[model samples]
Target: MKHKTPLLDQLESGPWPSFVSDIKREAEARAKNEKGVDFQIPVEVCEDILGVMELTYEQKRTHWKHGGIVGVFGYGGGVIGRYCDQPDLFPGVAHFHTMRVNQPGGKYYNTDFLRKLCDLWDKRGSGLTNMHGSTGDIILLGTYTHQLEEVFYELTHDFNQDLGGSGSNLRTPADCLGMSRCEYACFDTMALCYDLTNEYQDFLHRPAFPYKFKFKFDGCPNCCVASIARSDMSFIGTWRDDIKIDQEAVKAYVAGEIPPNAGAFKGRDWGAFDINAEVIDLCPTKCMAWDGKKLSIYTPECVRCMHCINVMPKA
Candidate 1:
């Protein structure tokens, strides 16, 4: 029967590795290694990759049966539970196995570190990876139960990397580009992230909470890391001091001497009046107003959100 994967098949025509072909390789390898074990390329995995379901269930029963709770000891932070409904049918993914590696602050990595990490995981665990999980950990999606400890040991003791948090614990803290690359930062988010993670190692490894909690930091109110929406504890840089007004700079901005937008938007006439209107509308306290060329802020009522300061860096 035809695979009915037109769009999926098209991916093979490109120079990039075909996702289907790769899984097919795994299927072939499984057939060779286990003489009597029956394993078929998972149609669900394929569907997820392409986001298209062209085929129906080939088996009356799939091998994905839910298993018992899955995790490693001493660390509540680094394991995710998964179960196959029909384990007898799918022996490979039978266990609710997950491996979580703590990510470095801000995702800054040298190619050497990446290469070494990949090599270790490939050697000891399943090659499949989520790359990054929702909790911002390096998610090794599958691994054998017997091999989890050894893999983690090698990763930690040898590579000096550690597992992230999971299940009702203080998860690995996350950070946005703070003093590193962004001028808007009021603090060194990277340094603080490292400090917090190291200090809270005990908390990360122990599940002592009523529910999972997360801490995330943003350099400024822009919150490029989605800290406010996603985290239970959100820290954003702000200033309590009054916003300094540079009338000359403001006039220059109004006169179009300064480029309002960067890159392709450079030429667009994002006049001062329009930008000011946008800023004023977003201010919750109704403390902002603009009259074509002049900008006014009710300093006393200002909440020190750093919103206007970030939006218009010149004024």
Candidate 2:
């Protein structure tokens, strides 16, 4: 049989590895001898996949088709309510797709955990998955109305995996890997993520607010996850106690040894780094002062903004 997309085939004629080429390879392999070869996909499914792959301005103008509402029992979290405009055309996918999976705290997953998850999805739903979608669930991309309960049961009872939130609920809380891998962390971000998720299961499954609320936690003021800007509810770990300063490490920084996390000094001045005049000059609160041999903190007025500590990690 000839490929329907001759233009997309032409794109593969060049040296560069086109994504369309990759999609074509997968489609070809599946059509020949693969598990997901023609499993309930639309007649135009290949064209639909290619349409998304090679998008045009006209492709962006898709019809507003999803007007139907659907939900599964015992959960308000996982069901993604939708309907195809022409249900008769897409009978296999007309009801809605469901998403239900427990997110690993700190985004940690063992190989066995991942393997089992994939095996289950291959058995129950479409083999397609998103490692994690924007909402931070292990997205099970396709399923029908009849199988939602069985899917939820197998996930919850057999695998011990809980469902993640959707709709106008508290979505699964996520965070940067805190005390596990980072030295700058003020708290155990992973543990907090787990704690919040478990404690707020009801809230996650129930929509109580006017709009969706998201929770993102960061271990330090560095905010590697950008939680502050994106999440509706953001929490970053901080120090209320005076920052621990190591005088010897300060000496090392001054001598330009620049030990990790203790601090880094301007390497310009060979052995005598200028501490006060240039380094701490522009602190918004002006709460830190470095004497010739020692650093002192006016702890009360320190706003915990992380400006000075970021520069001088050791000291």
Candidate 3:
């Protein structure tokens, strides 16, 4: 028996606000004057309704089921279990997405690996994704009734990458590009960040913690990543000792070869204005001395403030 399209039937059935009304109209028009309707009849429906129905049915079908598994990947990797909802679907299988570990500083996968992941995503589950979720993990949406382990095996076929960050765990850390390029850097922040990530991978993936943790590093005092503001753990490099002062360099600065205020030394109001008398007197090392005609640095007492160099630039 042929069934008239449900579209128009549904629309004319009620004035209730819905997309079902529109589709019912279309379906009725398409299957005009049809007799009996089969349960298999494919009536057009909105994507949202279809998705909702699919999810609802899936949940119902799998409810009370146990042992389903899911995985998340990004800054770190790990599997999660949903032992509570529909234990039937995951019988002996854990529920929840596994996390994929990430290299420190947000490294991207190589072309081949990326291609493989895309292919796997297309075949195994819902195409929906969270590129970098709050925990900094790549989130894959919707896994099947089974096949979690297979998916895990396929994804980790290459060298075992880490699944680093997740719930209650230390989050993926970030840092500035350190001594490699910047002149201001006192340490290799990038390397340090990576090392820390490796050293603390367990702390990253586990859910055992009093509170979520975050870490960040800066090569210098600039604090490029705002480590102090956002991170539970933060590091910034600075010299415990005074800045280095070259007496000859200071003289050269005095002779105009170097600008007195070109770098950090260029700031004003050093508590002294006169190069020979006031500024020199303030030097902790008594580095700066005046002969009433020419200016000289004791060299041994030079505290590296570059104050005398700034004032007596012509000495």
Candidate 4:
């Protein structure tokens, strides 16, 4: 039988997709003794999770509480303790602690690795996973307090994986794909991230900081990882060298024979390309000049704003 969840059902009515709907679908499927493509989490766990969510909405406050040290032996961080206040009403979530697994640099993963990791969590956790948390750790959401040690031991011994940082410890370091895929990347971001993570294992596992500290590395000025805005320490790759200019390609762009951004906007009719208006005029330092037949760049004053390169990619 489907339990009453009027508040949660209301979330499914809007245009935006809702997680409540997905959880309810899983709960209903489990209630009917339906087998799941992956290992099935107990139906009661899902229902209780929904029940607590409904109660939270009804009460206008959380039904959860947390405090005190809760982690595996020798490690002082990584596991977050969570408990339900209404244990009698929602027993399944009474000890739904969260664990953070340190993700591989650049988040590279194969199907076989993921399948095995998921199988481990399904057996010991609530079967929900967030690819990355706010700090870029793989979030293993919900597990019993008693199973924490077992999960950690298996995660380390079998998978050769470790937990990320939490509390006042140095939070997990994150990095963009960089040279792995992007042409603009100036350095090996993944390698640096891997080195730093391993080198500072003690700081990552122990609460030595006054507050949480984070490190984020971006391959180039693009800063795809949003390091500047989020992390305490940010590394953005840059070069002192000037950008190369192709005179013939410049003329092609100027004459409207070649598309801007290398025909990236070809699918849409965004009007003719104007190098003077788009590239020269938009330069932050105004270090570019076009004289109909040739293009000139004042490399000494160039800021590497990438405006010229962005508009005339080939040039």
Query: Which 10 successive residues of model 2 have the least lDDT summed?
Result: 38-47
Task: Evaluate model 3: give its lDDT.
Answer: 0.52
Tell me the lDDT of candidate 4.
0.83
**How far does residue 172 in candidate 2 sit from its true spot (Å)?**
1.3
lDDT of 3 by residue, 30-64 (tens): 34525333211122212222233334454555432
lDDT of 1: 0.67
Between candidates 1 and 2, the TM-score winner: 1
User: lDDT for each of the candidates?
Assistant: 0.67, 0.67, 0.52, 0.83
lDDT of 4 by residue, 1-315 (tens): 234789988999999988887777656654564434343234466678889998889889998887468999999899999888988888777878899999988888899889988777766777677888989999998878888998899889988889999999999999998889888788999999999999999999999989999999998777888999989999998886777889998998877888888777789887777777788888899988888888888888987766677677788
Sort by TM-score, best first: 4, 1, 2, 3
Q: RMSD, each candidate, Å?
A: 6.1, 5.1, 15.0, 2.6
lDDT at position 286, candidate 1? 77
Runs in model 4 lying further than 4 Å from the true structure: 1-3, 28-43, 255-259, 262-264
TM-score of each: 0.75, 0.74, 0.45, 0.89
Each model's total of backbone clashes? 12, 5, 49, 0
- TM-score of candidate 4 on Cα atoms, chains taken together: 0.89
Q: In terms of TM-score, which candidate is strongest?
A: 4
Candidate 4 has its poorest 10 consecutive residues by lDDT at 34-43
Which pairs clash in the backbone of model 2? 261-313, 262-313, 262-314, 263-313, 263-314
